[model samples]
Target: MNPSHRLSTFNITTLALGLAFLYLPIVILVIYSFNASRLVTVWGGWSLRWYFEFFNDQAMLDAAWMSLRVAVTSASLATLLGTLAALALSRGADFTGRTLFSGMLYAPLVMPEVITGLSLLLLFVALGAGRGFWTVTIAHTTLTMCFVAVVVQSRLTSLDPTLEEAAMDLGCNPARAFAAVTLPLILPSIAAGWMLAFTLSLDDLVIASFTTGPGSATLPIRIYSEVRLGVKPEINAICTLVIALIAAVIIVASLAAKLSDARGESGAPL
Candidate 1:
């Protein structure tokens, strides 16, 4: 083969290997979720026994529901607060201590989950606050908002500030100008941040473990505890369902974003 062809072949092989490395384990787990036998390793032909069992497990169902609620609440709060932080950092005039403020805003992005969780746990203890649903949600929001801020800040930096100014020049108030012009333009980023925050909060295990109180176990905690005893088909089944749900959400969101972009581009003047 020519040198260019050889390089193309190498890239293809690398891509294939990388994808297999990431997804092969997940594929095995998904396949075994339908296993007829109790053993996870042994393929006992395909059946939906485990799916039925998973749905019938009231504790697992409750934990899943709780996780959903926490994820939604935290993601929304994070998105809202993160957007505000991004606006301050990206749009507002430079002020004293701006660097310190920026560092603090992004600190949680690099902070270890264990450390973050421990700090929050200590704070809750010092405040004599009960640890439960709201505590878990707050912890998730704290860790996730930094990520949302990063995403929104990137979008804000790329936006044309003159668009908002032009709206204001057209007699719109500052808030109305943002709502009519800047908000629509940055909406895709806001949505992307929300999805990312939701995914992070949902997949979080370490922070949830530290902050969760009695009767507020999320799905990851429940799954981890069960896996400690032994891996069960039910665990596989539930995980597969969770994976499917997340995948569906991502696909729908991606399509909506693409459609929005297409419409915006089409309407722009030549």
Candidate 2:
């Protein structure tokens, strides 16, 4: 065989193996969600029994609702604050503390989650803020907003400043020019950041464990508690749903980005 051909074949085999390593467990869990038997591994034919059981679990339902609220509210708040931070980093003039501000903006990405969670937990205690839904939301917003800032900053850095400048020259103020010309172009990144924040909030367990209070358990917390007892088919069913939600968000974000590119190519506002 040709050396180049052999290398290509090896690369393909490596990629396939890597993908299987990551996804095979998820596939097995998804398939086992439909298992009728109480035993997780032994197949006793497929059915929707687990799905029905999952729906009937009131604690899980409440936890799911709480998780949704936290994810949506935190993601929205994070997206807004992150976009502003990104603008400051990418567009604002250099000034005193600019370096420090940029460092703070990206620090969360590398910070240990335990340290972040513990510090926030202490801050809440200092503020006399009771631990609960709002506390978890605050913690989540703090963590995920940094991720959003990183995403939006990349888009802002790559964008041409001339477009916004031209808008201002054509009678728009600075803010108006940004709103009219700059925002639309960078919106795909903002949308993606929001989705990422949402996923982070939904999937988080450690930070939520530190910040969450009684009667305000999130889905991950509830799932963890259940899994400690042993693997239940209901847990598998819930995991499948969570995976589907994350996958859907990614697909929508990708499509939105493609659409924005198409609009840009056609000389339309994007």
Best of the candidates, TM-score? 1
Q: Scored by CA lDDT, what does every candidate get?
A: 0.93, 0.92
How far off is residue 23 in model 2, in Å?
Answer: 1.0
RMSD of each: 1.9, 2.4
Off by over 4 Å in 2: 1-7, 267-270
**Candidate 1, residues 80-186: lDDT per residue as tens digits?**
99999999999775878889988998999889999999999999999999999999999999999988999999998998889999989999999999998989888
The superposed Cα distance between candidate 2 and the true structure at residue 259, in angstroms, equals 3.3
Residue-pair clashes per candidate, as listed? 0, 1
Determine the C-alpha RMSD for candidate 1 after optimal superposition of all C-alphas.
1.9
Give the least accurate 10-residue stretch of model 2, judged by summed lDDT: 1-10
What would the per-residue lDDT of candidate 2 be over residues 1-270, giving only the tens digit for each residue?
887666687798999999999999999999999999999989989999999998999999999999999999999999999999998888775777889998887888999999989999999999999999899999999999999999999999999989988998899998899889888988888998999999999999989999988899999999999999998989999999999988988997898788778878999556
Model 2 scores a TM of 0.94
